[model samples]
Target: MRYLRSRVVTFCISYALWLTLSFSVDWQHLLIGLLVSLFAAFLMGDMFAEQAHKWFSPRRYLWFMIYVFVFTWECFKANLDVARRVLNPHLPINPGIVKVKTILKTESGLTFLANFITLTPGTLSVDVNREEGVLYIHWIDVKTQDVEEASRIIVSKFERILKEVLE
Candidate 1:
C-alpha cells in the first residue's frame, strides 16, 4: 500500500513538472503526458519511490540547489584557469592520475561525486573501487603528490555538498 501511494505521488509530481515545463494542459496533451509519466513511473517504480522521499525533503532540496550554484561558479573559475594555462606558450599541464579515497558510503553518493568530478574541468573520475571506497581521478595538473590533500579538497568543496543533499 505504501509503495502504491508513493508511486502515484511520484507519477503525479512528474506529470505536473512536465506539464508546467513542456506542454499546455489541454485535454488531449494532459491525458497523453499523464499516461506516459505513469508508464515511466511504473517501469522505474522503485527508483521513483526511493527518490520521491528525498524530493519532499526541503532541506535536501535547498542544499542541492546551493551545491549546484557553488559548483557552477567553481566550474567557471576552473575553465578560465585551464584556458589560461592552455593558451600560454609554456603549457603548464602536469597531467596524471591520482587515487583519492572517498568517504561516501552509498553508491548514489559516490556516483554523484564521480559525475561531478568529470563534469568540472581539469579533472575526470576515471575509475571507482567499491571495495576500498577509492576513486581514481585524472587531473590535468598536480602540484603535489599528496592524495589526502586532493581528497580533502574534493570532499570539502563538493562531497560535503553532496552529503547535505544525499545523506
Candidate 2:
C-alpha cells in the first residue's frame, strides 16, 4: 500500500512538472508528458519517503509558497547589496569563507538551504558537513567571525521556514 501510494504521488508530481515545463495543452504533448511522467514515476517512486502523503498536504504546499517568496525577496536584496558594492569601490567587501551550523536534520532540508544561499548574490555555499550539521559558505562581506552570529545572519530566516516546509 505504501509503495503504491509513493508511485501515485511521484506520478502526480512528475506530470505536474511536465505540464508546467511544457506549457502545452495539445493532445500530442499531453500524451507524451503522460508517458514520460509514468516512466519517471515507475523508476523513482520507491525513493520517496514512506510518508509520501505529506507532500500532498495543503499546509506543506502553503509553506513552500511562502518559502518561494522569502527566497525571492532575499535574492533581490542580495542583488542590490552586491550592486552597491560593485558601484562603490571602497564599500568594504571582506571576502572569506565562514562555517555555520544548521538545525535542519534531513538531507533535503540542508540541500535546499544550501541552494537558497548559493542562489542569492553575495553568498555561495561551498560545502556541507551533514554529520556535523555545518555549512561552509563564502560571504562577500564578512560581518563577524562568530559561528552563532554568522548562522543567525546567513541561515536563520531560511532555516525557520525550511524546517516547516521541508524537514
Candidate 3:
C-alpha cells in the first residue's frame, strides 16, 4: 500500500516537473513525458521520503513560492554587497568558516538550506554536520563568531521558511 502510494506521488511530481520544464502541451510531448515520468517513478519511488504526503500540501506550496522571492531578494542583496567589496579597497572582509546551528531535522530541508546559502553571493556552505545540527559556512564578512548570533544572521532568514515548506 505504502509502495503504491509513493510511486503515485512520485509520478505526479515527476510529470508536473516534466511539463513545467518542457512547456509543451502537444500530445507527443505529453506521451513522452508520461513514459519518462513513469520510468523515473518506478525506479526511484521507494527512495522518496517517508513523509511524502507533505508534497501534497497546498500550504507548503504557498510557503515555497514566498521562499523563492525571499531567496531571490537575498541573492540580489548579496550580489550588491559583494560588488561593493570588490570595487572598494577600504572595505575589509573578515573571511572565515563559521559554524551555524540548524533546527531542520529532515535531509531534504537541510540540503535546501545548504544549497540556498551556497547560491547566495559572498557566502558558501562549506559543510553540513547533520548529527550536530550544524552547518559550516564560509562568509565573506564574519559579523560574529558566536554560534547563535551567526545562525541568526546567516540561517534564520531561510530556515524558518524552509521549515514551513519542506519540514
Candidate 4:
C-alpha cells in the first residue's frame, strides 16, 4: 500500500512538472513524458512517500500560486531598483553577506529559497548552513546587521509559503 502511494505521489509530481514544462501534448510527446515521469518516480520513491500527504491539497496549490506571483513581482521590482542604481551617478551598494536563518526544514525547500534569493535583484545567496538553519546572502542594500531583522526582510517572504508548498 505504501509503495503504491509513493508511486502515485511521484507520478503526480513528475507529471505536473512535465506538463508545466511541455508546450505540446501529441501522442509522441505524451508517450515520452509518461516514460520519463515513470522512470523518475521509480528512482525517487522515498521523496514523496512521507511528506506528499501534507501537500496534496488544493489549498496548498493556491498558496503556491500566491507565492509565485509574489516572487515574480519582487523580481521585477528588484530589477528596476538595480537598474536605477546602476544608471545613477552615485553607486549605492553595500555588498556584504549577512546571515539570516531559515525555518524551512526540507532540503528541496531550502534549495528553492536559495534560488529565489539568487534570482532576486540585489541579493545573492552565498552559502547555506543547513544544520544551523542559516543562509548567508550578499545584499546590495542591507538595512540591518541583526540576524532576525535580516531574516524578516529577506527570507520570511517565502519561508511560510514554501513550507506550505514543499514541507
Among these predicted structures, which one has the highest lDDT?
A: 3
**Model 1, residue 166: C-alpha shift (Å):** 0.6
Query: What TM-score should be assigned to candidate 2?
Result: 0.88
- Candidate 4: where are CA atoms >4 Å away? 1-3, 13-29, 47-50
Supply candidate 2's per-residue lDDT for 122. Answer: 80
Q: With candidate 4 superimposed using the best TM-score fit, by how many Å does residue 105's alpha carbon deviate from the native?
A: 1.2
Q: In model 1, which regions exceed 4 Å deviation?
A: 9-13, 48-51
Colliding residue pairs in candidate 3: none
lDDT of 1 at 157: 74
- What is candidate 1's CA lDDT for residue 162? 91
- Tens digits of per-residue lDDT for model 1, 66-105: 9889889878987898889989999988999888887787
Computed on alpha carbons, the lDDT of every model, listed in order, comes to: 0.81, 0.88, 0.89, 0.86
Once superposed on the true structure, which residue ranges of model 3 sit more than 4 Å away at CA? 21-26
Which 10 successive residues of model 1 have the least lDDT summed? Answer: 47-56
* TM-score of each candidate structure, all chains considered together: 0.85, 0.88, 0.87, 0.81
TM-score of 4: 0.81
